[model samples]
Target chain A: MTSLLALGILLLTAFLLLVVALLTRNSTPRFREIPALTRLVRTLGLSVEDGKRLHISLGHGSLLDERGGSAFAGLAALRIITEKTSVSDMPSVASAGDPALGLLTQDTMQAGYQAAGVEELYVPTTSRVTGLTPFSYAAGAMHIASNENVSTNIMIGHFGPEAGLLADISDRDYVTLIGASDNLAGQSVLYASTQDALIGEELFATGAYLGAGTSHSASLTVQDILRWLIIITLLGGAAAKFVGVI
Target chain B: MRVLTAVIAIAVGLMVLLGYFFAEFVGIQTLLLNWAVILAGVASLVGIFNLIAVHTDKVRRAEKGGVYSALLVIALVATFVFGLILQPQHQIMQVLLNGIILPVEATLMGLLTITLLYAAIRLLRRRADVMSVFFIITAVLIFLGSATLPTGDVPVIGTLIRPWVSQIWALGGARGILIGVALGTLVTGLRVLFGIDRPYGGK
Candidate 1:
């Protein structure tokens, strides 16, 4: 019965997302400014123009688990970043801690290149698995961030407190670091370590904020609607409990 | 090709999702999941080879960190060969794990404490905003609360405030973030299922 209820909710969310996506097909939606993403997008353009590399770290999040959600968002951001910077002297590189994520990142880069009509520029080594363990992953990504002439480091995925190491390198090397994570430890570590850190649901908003597609924006609208619904339900439940109703 | 890939993905995804609620599709879902697990193992091997190839190229080109790359490749290959020969359950493998891997990882974990402190200090120096101040204050209080002096715990901060802050405020905020994250996950999964957003090489 609980599983049924979960499925019902999932179906309802899917319906809402599709409806909102179709409704907003012709209309342009305005999103409130997220300074982190703004700075990231701006840095992306500058990095391309200046012939500096960009490093995206997709942490070791399993594709079969809930953690895969944030990593998928990171992949979407990577696609957009790759497409935009494919023509630059130094193309963007991505690192993943999980094998599935590593392969997917490579595929995403290839798709992005194909989309930009630069399939010849696609390099399989551009996206790879740096390390399997959390600390090792951070260490390897730190090497790339510090040594690859990368101007900006965008870390959006599942990470642990070990992310502080990468952020430390970014700070020491004077490279821009924009990071986010789904894990609480990772979030707290990133929040304290990085100057531009996306908190909570902001990590999921990467695709929408980066102009991935209208469907991405529509997903944001669905998230907003669902958030309000959840808030109302929680408040109502609390009120009922306060009034001696179970 | 993209359409076909999307169809297969969506069909498999729906079957797995439905298998959770209905018993009829559970067999197929399990079969698919097992296949995925096998594929993931192969992918890991592919990733390891890719890592070796990248480092090999670096060493060949004599890049600045080529020495480190060479060391890594040597260590990785040696480890793999030794593990395969002796088996992971062998005493030598256990000693290698306990003496080397575990200690190294533990040391890194210990390093996180200092890194976190340094970051907290840098955060204060970089941004003294309301959120940063609150974060630092809460962290300090939590640390202090968790510690005990020669005599006992601290005064009201430890006795009265810590439990409330951790159990109430922190729990509430974490729950809020979790809900938002769940909603985001749901929408993202839906997008993939509907073929609206494909990160799996689909155009």
Candidate 2:
């Protein structure tokens, strides 16, 4: 079992390296002076708009945060947002529940805007610590998802059942909500939305999705290949064990 | 160099993964896991220090809502005292965490359900769309299915609905979502692998 699991890990690592190599061959994310999201909002929406809003929810973090990799996903997601949405001068609203997460998220969002050269759009009040409760967090997110003016709500991180309600509410309001939750129920909400679900490690794969940077995306891709390899290896091992092939 | 960190990380991950079924490898994995826990406990002090610094500075500046900072301090100290003063194995800390924090968190979470219900009911009300209505039906049915399974009054009905929704969701919707999420993760990881993103630098 250990060998199989390790084999999965090895396979994932190799795949990640491959993805990294492939992406590096292409251009990485470049922050535009004006957010491209503005075009989407201005041309797509009614008359005038405050531009699109990118909502990023950093998960509760992992049992092992030695390097803070879990929270790193949220921060990386913000980076990609900064690169794309602000190319034509748009805004993004971010909020968090965990204080530590709140602090980190604030920095990342601000950094995102700075990278895009539109730090002016970063809202201080919007990046508040929603609540100490899942419900309160849900309540706060629902407000963002359903409110007018905000175009795209990229909901990511550690979410629960209320997350489904929040994601569904975005579609209800004709707003686009890219929901990514780590939990099973939260994942189910993704399926309920106009888009498909982004669950588990996908929550941390934001950087790759938006073409933000390379390393994180590479690691994520590698994990996927590794996952499948692990699955196949299991069958191989089962056969071996059954026939005493070792 | 990034290579060193990447290599070590992959090595550790592989060892841990291998340790899953291999008893011999389990020893090293357990040790590494313990090291991880110890690291977490140690790094938590950074958070504690940050809290202290932020609140202390707020109290010193006497800023608006600084009193709330004081309250936070009070809460932290009170909780810590109760935790350390009581027997190490006692439920005192657990009581505080569960009794006080849990209820507040749970109530707040429960409140979202109302909003969720509203969002579900109002999904198609204000929109000029059919997909919104489709979403509404799916949301309502899923909600009802979930809400009903908990009552436990009708064992037969509960038994039927539980697996029904579970499989429908797991095999149907969940599987699809998993694929997207998987693809997204793969892409993101690839970007990272190529140094397209440097998350380690606090960006």
Candidate 3:
């Protein structure tokens, strides 16, 4: 019974996202996340004269694998951060494990910063290519986190169990922390977030809210509806199950 | 011919993807899974060949770790023979690996944690800000909550935190983070599957 409910929710969520993605693809890409993040940026200290560094990692997925697309989300997040950070004269640093992702992440950040009218805020060296091993990559990230003196760390992409280790260590040690990752372990780290903002679906909402492109905004609107439908169905199912209804 | 390759790929792809939802289609699903396993097993030989080629080149060049490579060969041969000759549950082989090798990795990880802890402490010394305060408070809370030690014996402290700690640490903060992460993951997955933002060279 529980299995059936879970499957139902999964299918419904997928369906909703599919519809929304299709509808909004050509209109505007940045949807829900832009305003919130822009407000967050305005709320932050741009007057301090240096833009905060942003770190975005596309998890352990291989760029070489034909199936790999985890890093793409990181590229997307880079665009928003780039635009916002640049306009405010706040610097953003983005990094990737795959060399391919490294190229894309830097390009996107540069584009966003250029849009924001603060091209200097985009530092190319910040988007690094590291060793392929998950732990080795994590170690490289840890080093960069310490060295760069970044104000916000944003992670968006696929992650594994090792992600928790980095999140825990980063939060425990550094004063600069803005974490966003799809890794299950990231939740534990994010839950502990105090000074920095750890966004949820808000990252997906970015493309639409910012009006970056059509497909992006549409996806967010669909995701919002889908998320609520899931909650309602699950709640209804639970209630029915308690009353002994199938 | 190219079209045939593409056709086969899409057909097999749908089966692999859809199999997750329709486990009731047992026969077809099992055949695909079994074939995947077999292919993976065959591919393991490729990795072994690569390892040998690299190590042989290292040994021939008398690289810095060439002796370590030589020792690895000796250990690999011995362990393979011992493993095949002896049952897995046999005492000696288990003892050597479990007793020695396991501890080494564990100790190294433990050492890394300790050094990491020290670095965090030092960072706190340098910059005493909002982010630092949040991180320290949360780490201590989680660590203390998970610890099963003689701390419960302490009258004022353990009793005070025991019940509420779970609510404060585990339920409140943990649940929020979990929901955020789940949402992020779901969005990411949708983005990939739909090719809205293709990182992979898309068709």
The most accurate candidate by TM-score is 1
Report lDDT (CA) for all predictions: 0.89, 0.57, 0.55
Best of the two (1, 2) by TM-score: 1
Cα miss at A107, model 3 (Å)? 15
What is candidate 3's lDDT per residue for A1-246, written digit by digit as tens? 766765676666667667766665555343223333564455334423554455556665544342143355556656765665564443555555554455555566666766667666655554555434466456556554655555555566655444545565566655444455544354333434323434455544544443446556555565567667657877899999999997
Better of 2 and 3 by lDDT: 2
Q: Which 10 successive residues of model 2 chain B have the least lDDT summed?
A: B185-194
Measured against the true structure, the TM-scores of the candidates, in listed sequence, are: 0.98, 0.61, 0.54
Q: Write the per-residue lDDT of candidate 2 for residues B148-170, one digit (tens) a residue.
A: 44555345334575457667754
Model 2 scores a TM of 0.61
TM-scores of the candidates, chain A only? 0.98, 0.72, 0.63
C-alpha positional error of residue B65 in candidate 2 after TM-score superposition, expressed in Å? 5.1
Candidates 1 and 3: which is better by TM-score? 1
Candidate 2, chain A: TM-score against the reference: 0.72
